[model samples]
Target: MEWFLFQLFRTELIHREHPSSPMRSTAQQTSSEIFLAAVKRGAKRRARLSQKILAAGKIFSTPIASGNGEYLIDLSFGSPPQKASAIVDTGSDLIWVQCLPCQSCYTAIRAKFDPTKSSSYAAGLPYQSCNTSCQYNYMYGDDSSTSGALSFDSITIRTSTITNVAFGCGHRNLGTFAGAGGLMGLGQGPLSLISQAGAITSKIFSYCLVPLGINKTSPMYIGDSAAAGSDIAYTPLLNNIVNPSFYYVGLTGISVAGKAVNYPAGTFSIDTSGQGGFILDSGTTLTYLNTAAFTAVVAREAPRRPTLPWCFISLVWISPSLPLPPENIFVAVDTLGSDCLAMAASTGFSILGNIQQQNHWIVHGIVNKQVGFKTENIETI
Candidate 1:
């Protein structure tokens, strides 16, 4: 078993010649403009995901890929360890990478993984011991798809090496990955990297997201290092049988300032049909609340800052009262010259996105089925 720490960088920083360069865009734009654009894009993508989940009435076991997510991590695969950059997605399962003999792949990818080059590469699961290769086809909600063989190899994260890791060797992949080779799925699913490497990771992981535009790499801890500190708050993770991959929390209600926003008893709960619930998603940039809840919260917070239409206060989650400061709740829109709420309204499902998670040391205690949070300056950590 191995445990170590690694760096988590935002995908937008990949092509930047300098820290201030525009993210995911060819045109010159200010940092504020880039921030606004990314937030809007994430909100739209999240809406689509919510709809897809509701339409299917369950979280897809195959998992949907969010193209060019906000954060990514560098990983090394194979025996000697071939380097590759992959999106870090807590919303999806299945760690995969673009492999050689590609039917279709992103032209921007500088290096395509050649499994044959690795001495440790194996065709399928070790338990299977079958002569035939295990094939997989993953279709995302946004039409992006990847078809590959279920393969085994060594994956290196920082200095720690985890052997016999299961990952997809994507022969055919189609998506706007922004040069990323593939995705590292951290979702609570059987096929997720955490689950596959449970023996070494101890089914524990934690990450502290740096504030946007900080030009700093965040820290992700695995195994014993990921345990919650004394100052952290613990919340039981709700189980959604239909959508078991997602991390659902017990959200009683939200409060603006000291006042609690009015909403129904089970507004944030997953119904018998698994329709509506609140999930913590690392892939989504902005937080989303159920329409009714959103309206109530906004109505209370927006009135405080009449001059700044978009300005809103922090959200205090009841029961445990996890407070998110204004810095984590708002995004500066350069054009408007005012901060906008980094939140949106969803029809049913709600998400606690990355923006709201900034500077928070979030621990996912998989074995205990709990999540812990503590405020900390991520850059220092």
Candidate 2:
């Protein structure tokens, strides 16, 4: 069945599984409902990686670290393009950030939230009517319980500084993410930046991420969308439960420890918002691979797991990849040499999350109605 990308309501959501690592600190929030309403349904096909490492004329964002161990994005909102520091999350849909006169502020960062700041900042920008079934609330179970407000405004990127595009400042914001100011929701919605840009007739997309442990040349961009161009190739968007149309990047390849694997890591991906422990995230601190895949890695490194009864699960790298991994679940990555897909899941196997995605630039692109990926700058690659 082809997953379709339609309007998003509050009733669709899914829970994420925990990681393989036993002792780690992560967020307390967990989603249990499955979200497939907005999935872009299509058949999967094979594709090659783009020869270019980085796409030309790319669109990106400048992500800042929050006390919550997550990255905060500078979402464009309000009049004259006031950039607010919000979390660039794919897990949820309500993209909200702290309003003017925040309770606290970033040390080196500044938010220009002036109610009277610009000609575009009109008092009471008016709420949008949910005509397309695009109602959203920020509650845990697919119900946009948070029920953020919809204030219309103009937003510009720091690069070209384009003026006056249809953007929104979330109605409500929570300072939960490690001293985070707010959030920039990246899910499929009318509120997403994707639906805001007036410049392109076709759909435009952008991502702002900082490679973990790499701290130089963190840049963001606008227009000249990489996902829309061919310089960066892509495969078809999946219609599965695990990898919704959340922009999965096809991997040209992946390596375990210090050696490059022969087969490429096919497109089974998603851009999770901010994951602490037992969650998915951008720039997640570690790489969490499938137990079989990860155990193969561990055996290569430590040879064998601790001689405990359930210390480590024995796994083999599944040569043939699946179009979709699974649904309503996430896999956890235990240490390299651990046992039985060490998941906190009392039910099924481990669901893959961020632990398997550390130290990599997972990219996204669209070509001939498809998306793809290619990992770069590794000891093995």
The estimated TM-scores of all candidates read: 0.88, 0.49
Over the full model, what C-alpha lDDT does candidate 1 score relative to the true structure?
Answer: 0.74
The regions of model 2 sitting more than 4 angstroms off are: 1-69, 100-118, 121-137, 140-148, 161-172, 198-211, 220-222, 225-233, 241-245, 248-283, 290-301, 304-361, 366-369, 375-381
What lDDT does each candidate get? Answer: 0.74, 0.32
Query: What is the per-residue lDDT of model 2 for residues 330-351, given as tens digits with 9 covering 90 to 100?
Result: 2222335322321221111122
Superposed by TM-score, candidate 2 places the C-alpha of residue 16 at a distance from the truth, in angstroms, of 23
For residues 47-128, what per-residue lDDT tens digits would candidate 1 score against the true structure? 6576556765544353463556777777789978898878777888889999998889866444888998999999976565
Query: Which model scores highest in TM-score?
Result: 1
